[model samples]
Target: MKKPIKKQKAVLIILLSNIFIAFLGIGLIIPVMPSFMNIMHLSGSTMGYLVAVFAVAQLLMSPFAGRWVDRYGRKKIIIFGLFLFGVSELIFGVGTNVSVLYISRILGGISAAFIMPGVTAYIADITSVQERAKAMGYISAAISTGFIIGPGIGGFIAEYGVRLPFFFAAAIAFLACFSSIFILKEPLTKEQLAEISAKTKQTNFISDFKRSLNPHYFIAFIIVFVLAFGLSAYETVFSLFSDHKFGFTPKDLAAIITISSIFGVVVQVFMFGKMVDILGEKKMIQLCLIIGAILSVASTVVSNFLGVLLVTCLIFLAFDLLRPALTTFLSKAGGKEQGFVAGMNSAYTSLGNIVGPAMGGILFDVNIHYPYLFAAVILLIGLGITVMWKEKQLAESFAE
Candidate 1:
């Protein structure tokens, strides 16, 4: 048991670092992607499609990846996924055409689908119900740290060339891949391994797939879908808004993302654990949704650069508060089938990703502020769903 615990901690560290590196790769490209597209003379709709393609690919692949993680081991899948991510980044760095960019994003999405669910399941394997929220919060903090650094570094390098950010991202992903190979260990016991194998053998893939689509899991999936849709709207449009409306440079936009990420890290590290303990997952999620909705709406009205920056930070804080609670709730709802649940969550998030940028791009065409208004409405709807979920007691019972 002691050995298991030690291995669990080691796996958590590896997973955290893996998530950080992946986020770094994604974040590094985000601030510069539109500009890069502009340099290539791509249309706004085309850019939106490019972003949507990533989500679409992830959505298509996540269910299978999740099943594989449950049947196979998490460590092998994660390492392989990271290597693929590294290769995708390398391809993006070398390729100049829009077709190449789309292919690269598809590769990245597939890698992400595999990596994220596998890592989350690995965490679920090692952690108790009570410790799960805190663990997830730490993982979220790692992601926040990556977001804080990636944009800054990418923006600095992007001044040289658009491909530089991709190259840097490739380097980071390679580092993460190497780290996973050397430092990560499998966390499953022999019994658990046998059980997973037996289930895979006894149940057909279709049945196993259908079993993963539980209603409780679907409820969590809907919440993630709405949350991600709203967040992605903000993410896709924010830099463009800053540039068009406030005349902010790439560096300035990167700074805003960096500052927002700092706030996110602080909330995830210090406040999320305590919030989960005090308010419980359901109430915490409701509170976060309310706050996030209000702040997201407010972001539209804040015209000045400094004011927008401040509001953006608040929005990130609300997200930080929301994410850990939601993740814990989702994992709990998954119970023994953690990988399938994580995959469903990933698929829903990908669905949101598909919808968010497309909607934001449409609104961006209409008006710069329209996406935030729409996001506010969606988030309000999410709040209502959270209040009406009727599973508060269920969540409390599952808490560690």
Candidate 2:
């Protein structure tokens, strides 16, 4: 049964709030990282390893998290994840040694694995197919907004104490977690659960991955991986690129990112769904790939700050649009298997996150421009994949 409009709206607001807080927590630590490293006397390699560890943990946990979301229930997984996220932040804030920080990051990654798929599946449960694109846009917007604001807030609060931001993030997460337990009702009822249960027998990650290779889903899944890989590759070294090429400071990089992110949020809120409606999912995906590919190369040639900022905004806008569009398309195709498909999506994304930065770091060492060039090549490949995608196959897969 469909939820009434007002209740649905309220539920979506709460869900987006949790998502915002989660990403906020992730971003809050970014500004404090240098400080933390100084305190621990950690090397740059250790910092890189810290990032890899989180992605690795998230990647390994995502498939199981997705399955649990389907089997146990979305609310259960979300609440549990939030609690884990809170505890992880608290540990990180207080810990003095490297090993404790690693443990905290691993737990943080596991929490993310649980939270992301659960939220996507929950949104699928609440919104109709026609309503999903806009809902997904809102989800993406909340995430972008949280991440954009988090660093600014973190930088400001760091004057009080370097560890304070993590504690603050933990407090907010716990508040959200408790609020959810009391207020967020399970969207799936008995009939929905039975239907989902019938379709989804317990399966391992490998089996689920193989199953996702069906004609309809394979292209979308590939798109997800390619998009994430390309974006992460582009972004991982962006600060270094700016500083190397243009002598940009931390404030300059932050300003560029902030402007781009704010523009992205405005577009997602005001124009994203309408544009998706006008362009259709396949065309929208293709267009975004084209934009990303072109601007990535353009980034290498821009000499002036304004030119760089403009190109960066366009690149990020393409990426921001692509994410929710893919999610909406997948949600429409997923039908009763929303959790399964969402899990697979998260897994592929984690794979991209892991590999993209590793490769980007290596390429950055060899040539400053190589990462952007590589990203362009990868996105062009994604564009080629989209060109071969067929709408009929998507409809037929859902019919099955």
Candidate 3:
């Protein structure tokens, strides 16, 4: 007889695969989005709005999605999320109107609200404290791998037509849905269910919401927000920088991003866990932020394509280190209320996404280099906040 699958193994496979497919969809669009907007006759401001709208939708839905995941189960929510994502991708691929594109992004955001928090809580449910960092690293690796391949393929297809990439994205989302439905077994144990129920009985929705709003969590969220904002700005303006300043084609930008993703995947998969253990999450975060800030600053000064590529790689390497450390820390900090904490973390990221591109668009309009400089300053601010913050006090309070 075939042996039953181990719960940890099952959860890891499901989470990683789901994240891979979800990010693959996103990757497919990244290289094509700006040109697609230009084709649709969208103004710069309108394009910013279009990009920000997804984050807005995610922000609005995250709190509820978190609570629902806690109330229900992870597998059901994830499957539903995958379904929604598939539908949204199909809409984006087929729609001709800009308004339809906006609506599609909104729907995609809602799917993200479900997928991200659910996957995080699911990982928390299955992994032990000792194993959490490494497991989270694997998830990050999956995402980075998706980023590596998605844009390259999208850029190739986009050479023919912009809409083709969306159709390709839709196919990927559909594959994720099918995988979740068939391959992902439920991972929750009876003990976990009882624990969740007991916690739910003690806390109301307001209290749950308030838990993540505490000083320590809030500060961590802010750090994530600032970092994400900077990264988003870089993402929004990098293509323009490539085209205008370096005379690089879309394919060239795609190749650069692919290289960054390769570096990111390597760090997250092989180095992040050891770094967290050696330096600790807080110190690791500080180090990453410092390096990222310097890299962002350098990107502004570097005009040559090779120099820009090197700086970009450095920035993404720092980002790769930061992501798993912060996520593992946040998930642990949430303790028994992993769903709520994951939701709040996701909300902070969405807020960053909303703010970053919008700010980048405005800066791009003024001067191409301004966005990277602005991002460097924000990362410096985040570094200051991290240094002064007292983590132990916050952990004690949350423990209560």
Candidate 4:
């Protein structure tokens, strides 16, 4: 028997709401960073350190966050994470110095560690194997929409004050937390929930990680790491790069990110599902690698911000498509290990986030263009990996 449509719709809505709010909070700060740099008297290296610390916290917490999701319940974790996210933003909003800001970022990372893994595993739990990719794509689309709208809203509101976005983000997060508590419902049965929860408490993080490293997932893990590494590396220096290279203002940065993210949303919502159906995960991964490399290089050669925005749109579209496709492949291979696999997926992403910003900061100090140039070269490794790995066949259940 199929799950009821009302319940499916509720799950989808709650998940989408949760994801959109989380990403919007993150994006809400992007357009105001230049102002932040000036007000806080921050250097490129300082910015890099600020960005990296969050990842470090996430990296450390991701493994356990997964375990908690499996052992506890997804709705509990999601609500708690959103509440933490709200508190972190409030910390940023009220902080007087960089020291206080560091505390806020650490909190943000911890929140992400909880929120993302819970969201992914929840989607896997509720969705059928055949529909997982499309479902993931919808989640990605929600994220993209947040990314698209966030900067524009941030830029507009930022005219009042650089820190205004943080307060606004905090309020939005609080709203999400409130909504989640009231609206979200677990999809699992008492027996199923008890079985999953019962088994997880006995396992340690290291042991769970080892179990998660099933050979089938090794390449999936690497793909996430590489993609996050390249993207975060590029992102760390983005504000600095545009400011130095194009003399871009906060508004200019906001416009570019908004346009590109809108394009990303369109591709994920409309194109990603179809592409996954046609090209298959392997071929699609190959294509993202090739395009990602080209765009990383192409971004630097652009004559103006408009040119940069155009290339960025294509790059985001590639990333948005590839993420869901890869997740679909991993979810299919996960057997009953959805929470563990999702946790490892986040762990790898956090690793990339940790390394990418540090590398970007160091390279930016040496030369503003070096980060993007080097990222292009690094992404070629991804292209190579996709060729070397042959994924396991999709489950027979997915044949529908």
Return the top candidate by lDDT. 2
Candidate maximizing TM-score:
2
Clashing pairs in 2: none
lDDT for model 3, on a 0 to 1 scale? 0.81
Q: What is the TM-score of candidate 1?
A: 0.89
In order, the Cα lDDT scores of the candidates are 0.81, 0.90, 0.81, 0.82
Q: For residues 226-252, could you state the per-residue lDDT of candidate 3 as single tens digits? A: 878988888888888778887998678
TM-score of each predicted structure versus truth: 0.89, 0.97, 0.89, 0.89
- Candidate 4, 272-353: lDDT as tens digits: 8788888877888889888988998998899886688888888877877878877887777765656777778888999988
Error of 1 at 197 (Å): 4.7
lDDT, candidate 1, residue 318?
A: 81
Model 1 lDDT on a 0 to 1 scale: 0.81
Any runs in candidate 3 off by more than 4 Å, and if so which?
A: 1-10, 31-45, 157-162, 189-191, 194-210, 394-400
Q: How well is each residue in 1-400 modelled by candidate 1, as lDDT tens digits?
A: 2333344666677789899899888889876877887788899778767777888999888878877787778888898899999999998888778889889889999999999988898888788776778888987898788877887778789999988899888887888889888887777766776687566544344654466455566556778899889999877888877888889987787678778888889878877878899998888888888888888788877888789889999888887777778888888877666777787778878888888877887899899989888888998999887776776546553652
Model 4's TM-score against the true structure: 0.89
Candidate 2: regions farther than 4 A off: 1-7, 397-400
- Candidate 2 matches the true fold with a TM-score of 0.97
What C-alpha lDDT, on a 0 to 100 scale, does residue 15 get in candidate 3?
78
Position 90, candidate 1: lDDT: 93
Instruction: Report how far off residue 328 is in candidate 2 (Å).
Output: 0.5
